[model samples]
Each structure stands twice: as C-alpha cells, then as structure tokens.
Target: MTARLANKRSFPHPPHAPPADSPALSIFSPIIQVFSRELQRQPDFDLLLAELCLDHVWTEPSKRDSKGEVANKMFLSHNVLSQDFANFFIGSLGQLRSIRVVHTVSNITTSGTMFTLSCRDAAPIRDGDLTVVLGLDNSISFYSGHVKCAVAVIAR
Candidate 1:
C-alpha cells in the first residue's frame, strides 16, 4: 500500500470520494462556523491541491496539474487531521480555489482570520463525518495539528 504522506497511513478512498452527481460536502461546516464567530469577535482577515487520482512511477514521479488537465474533475483538501473525514471528493475548484479569506489583522489593532470553503458543487457532510479543523498559534502558519494515531483504511 502507498502512503498518503511520509507517514505510511491511509483512509477511505475512491469509495468515500463523492460521486460526480453528489452534493457538496459540508464536513468543515462546524469549523467554518467557529472561525466565523471568531471573526465576529475580532476586527478581520484574508486567505486560500490535489491527489484525487493516484499515479505510480518508480523513478520519475507522475504529477497531475488541474490547469494542464481541465478534464480532471476530482481534487480536494484531504482532511487527514480529521481522519480523512472530508475524504476524497470532486470540488468546485481545486484545493486552493476551495478556500477564500480576507485579512484585517494587526498586532496593535484589529485581529482575525476567516476562510470560506466554496462547495459550489460539493456534498453535505453527514453526521459524525470527518473534516478539516484549524489550529491557532503564536505566529501565522499554513497548517498545524498532528495525528496521534493513523491506522490505514484501504479499499476492500
């Protein structure tokens, strides 16, 4: 089995991947709401991959770029932190396009960070489903959080 990251761990795949006809998933809704409330409390903010398809090349790695392949419909922000709750799915736009935000933060004055997930054609997140969550830090960073334990969940 191939590893999702340097760490050899896997989660539900193609099966969990939302079908082309499925609705947008809101697995990140709660997290979105939490950040929304934070924005209400603070002064402001701003913001912004894909491995939907697996490629295997021993020597020269095969990479997929949405721009080069417009026909490639499946792309996403794999919420590994959430145990792949968001799983694999067809996104309205690629991972980067999926998230949006405005920055209005300053150490002396206003402070806040909010990002919007555009699920234009995504599916609704079911109860108990996993999704991405954010982490607050002393300094701004791209991603945070760790997987205390990650057991593989391969396709049967």
Candidate 2:
C-alpha cells in the first residue's frame, strides 16, 4: 500500500541552528548548569523516568494487512518524532513542574483525553509561549493544575 499526504507544511528545513557563540559554550553556561541542578533537586526528579513517560506510547497503528484493517500493536521501541515536536516537549519538561500521561484503550472505548498547556512566559516570541494540544484517540493525556499539586506534594 502507498501512503498519501493529507497535508503539508513549508518551514525551514532545520528549525534551529547552533550559533558560533552558543549558550552551551558561553560564560552563562555555569548559570544554566546551576539552574538545571536546582531543577533536578527540587522534587521527585527522575528526569530520565519523566522523559521516558513523556515520550511513551502504548499502542501504535501497525502496518495494514491486505484487508487494510489497521493492526494495533504494542510499541516496542521509541516512536519516530518530528524535531519541532521533540523540542516543544523537552522545553516543556524544563518549564513545567510535571507532565502526566494517561492512555486508555479497550474494546468499546475510542475516545481520548484532550487538554492544553498554555505558557505565559516573559516574552512569548523568544520563550516560545504557546498552547499545545495533545492526544486524539484514547492515547495521550495531560492535566496541568493537578500535576502541579501532585508535584508540590511530592516536593514537600
């Protein structure tokens, strides 16, 4: 079977380019390092675990058989992701206290959770303050205030 493009977008091939004087190599690198250390010590850290959960997906659409019925299979390894989306998620992990994902897939349920995370940073443009909507078909879920409270409690 051949794949069809339902839509398309035209953006810079590489969304972000590393500069000659990148922050990673700048004098402020120490400050950034302290900030990351502080973030890790704040609460139930485990950045690695959070990262895995943030990227994990239970079921993905397997290749269709001759009959064209999409076969559902457990995602064995990592999912193929877009650079833009990956950057958004990584940035969110640093800014937000916690992110929660809940996926419910059963025989009779086909509806997923819908939620948004609106960032109101100092400069919307440079900080990339935007609303992200995720999860479509009983797959991904996000809860903001609840996650904050949970993280707060864990930190305490």
Candidate 3:
C-alpha cells in the first residue's frame, strides 16, 4: 500500500527579475520606496487611535451613544480618510486578528475601497466596535463607538 509521489519538476521557478529599464519596474521602485519609508515611521496604537476619534466621517444620523455602552456592530470605510490611518496603525501595532477588504456600492455605481478590520482575537475587548485614526498632513483625528475599549488605554 505504498503511495506514489508526484513529479517535482513540474513546478519550476519563474524567470529572473525583469530588465532594469522596464517601465513597470521603474514605476514600482518609487512606490516601494514610499511604502518602506511609511512603514518605518509607523505611529503607536494610542496615537493612531486618538487620531481616528477626531477625523471619523460619521454616516447619516451622526448620533452618540451614552458613555460605557458597547457597540455590538458598526462599519467604517476607507473613503472616510481613517482607513489609511488604521492600516498603518494596525500594521505597525502588529496586533490585528484579521483585515479584510470589502466591496461596497454607492447610489449610482459599484466600487470598493473599504477595509474591514476584525480585531476579535487581537483586541478582544474592543472587538465589536469600529475605531479609526486618520492622518492628514500634520492633523490627526480619532473616532470610535462607545463600545470600543482598548486595554492599552485602560492601563493609563
């Protein structure tokens, strides 16, 4: 009852890097550099969270919940200016349970740019709330639901 092995040569590696002058390569280099520099300057979680609270784009019915209430659900969008900030925050914090890109359609068209971050395991206490931080020039905004609670902030 011995099992036979499949051929190993069928999975050869792709060709070497593209020539230096390739337009795609040239365009990609600067993008990569900017990404690397941004990563290097990633901010701490508290700072990021604070920024989110200030810049959040509230959906229609911009209402506030009573303090200490926990939001079981909420949604945030990349178009809110907070998405990029959250990405950098979570990426730098290295504590995200999962990050998913969701597609949403507006009244007249269908498109997508929103990122849904579920931090259940990573930030269990704040799991159900939508929190974000936006970084625009030198300004910062922070926004979160009443349910959002972070151990990092509690300790302070």
Name the best candidate (by lDDT): 3
Off by over 4 Å in 2: 1-17, 20-37, 50-64, 71-156
Once superposed on the true structure, which residue ranges of model 1 sit more than 4 Å away at CA?
Answer: 1-67, 71-152
lDDT of 3 by residue, 77-136 (tens): 232322222221233322221233333352222234333333332221233244533222
TM-score of each: 0.15, 0.19, 0.19
Alpha-carbon shift of residue 142 in model 2 (angstroms)? 30
- Please write out the lDDT profile of model 2 over residues 1-156, one tens digit for every residue: 223322223433333654546765586778989989888788766556632333433232346224433222111111122111111221322221112233345222223332224332111121222222232232222232222211111111
Ordering by TM-score: 3, 2, 1
Model 1, range 1-156, lDDT digits (tens) per residue? Answer: 445563434433465576544545466667879988887886544431232333521121236443432312322232334422112222434321222112234311211322333232322223323233221222112321112122232233
Q: lDDT at 20 for candidate 1?
A: 46
Error of 3 at 85 (Å): 33
TM-score, structure 2 vs. true: 0.19
Positional deviation of residue 112's Cα in model 1 after best superposition, in angstroms? 15
